[model samples]
Target: MKQSEIIKRLSDKELKKQVFLSQGLLLIVGVGLSFIFFDTFADWNSIMGWKPKQILFYGVIPGLGIVLLDIFIMRIFPEKHYDDGGINKRIFKNQSIGFIFVLSSLVAISEELLFRGVLQSVFGYLIASILFAVVHFRYFTKPVLLLSIFSISFLIGYLFEVTNNLYVTIAFHFTVDFVLGLIIRFKL
Candidate 1:
């Protein structure tokens, strides 16, 4: 389909719904892929040597650190780092902050599971992080943001490599998304 055709058929609300649903679908696909390849859900934690409780401490810690790095970059180049290239128009035009929060959590968890947990675990950090950055091609024009994304991807991947805990990475991803979602919602 042409860009114009897609734009015409998908209003902002419709696009948001599709994106939200697609993210959920990605989670299922990621898990399926993991199971098919590894055949051992139990090994998820063993990969990083992590426990459930470690997620609470390590996830948020790394997430918060990334957020601070984001803030620092965005503050210096607000237009470059903060702009979404009309993504907010497709999502949040009609939705409430609560809805955005829910979506953000879903996106974070799903993305972490797929990227850090599955892809990184299978392919290693360098390749997985590259794939993660490539997927966020929207940030390409904004060099600082693109670099930040790649860096964050590596950090999350590194955390997973060291801790071997999906929950920890999920926690980090969720925290970053939640706070950043709020900030963007409020334009803070």
Candidate 2:
């Protein structure tokens, strides 16, 4: 199928709601698995780079940089921005600052916990990144977007390895989502 047709189907309100529901579920699943299978969230705080400067360098800089790069790419090829993976544009626009914070926090925490925290622990970085990319199934319709997701996931995995802090990955993820979420909220 053409990318346009797939994006058209994905943009429907029902599909957007489904994605929202699934992301909500991701938090539960991640926490549940962490409790049931793993023993500790201890290593989640094992920050090799504990200094604020390091955190900014490793997490915030790359996080913001990638988001900016995405914006540039999306601007250049406007159609590439169609890959929302079912984020409800209307809900995004309607959300206030506090509410958008909560929503964006939820997204960052849930996905990072599962993919980087849980899965990366078990499967290692490369495999976990591949799984993470695969879970973003909508992007597959556009190979470039799929590649982008995989590459970002890999980078996040690398950051997690270096910092040994789940929060760093969460920060990166949060930065991207919250910024983009706000942009979508206002722009559209």
TM-score of 1: 0.83
Q: Report the error of model 2 at residue 42, Å.
A: 3.6
- Model 1 over residues 1-188: C-alpha lDDT tens digits? 84446755877778878887889888997888888768665666465554666886788877787778777876788574556566754575546778877887898878888888788878888988888888777677777767777888788888878787877887888888877767667667
For residues 10-118, could you state the per-residue lDDT of candidate 2 as single tens digits? 6455555765688889989988887876766565444323567666787778989988988787778766454554444655776677766877788888999998888
Clash pairs of candidate 1? 48-163, 48-164
Compute each candidate's TM-score over C-alphas: 0.83, 0.81
Best-performing candidate as measured by TM-score: 1
TM-score of 2: 0.81
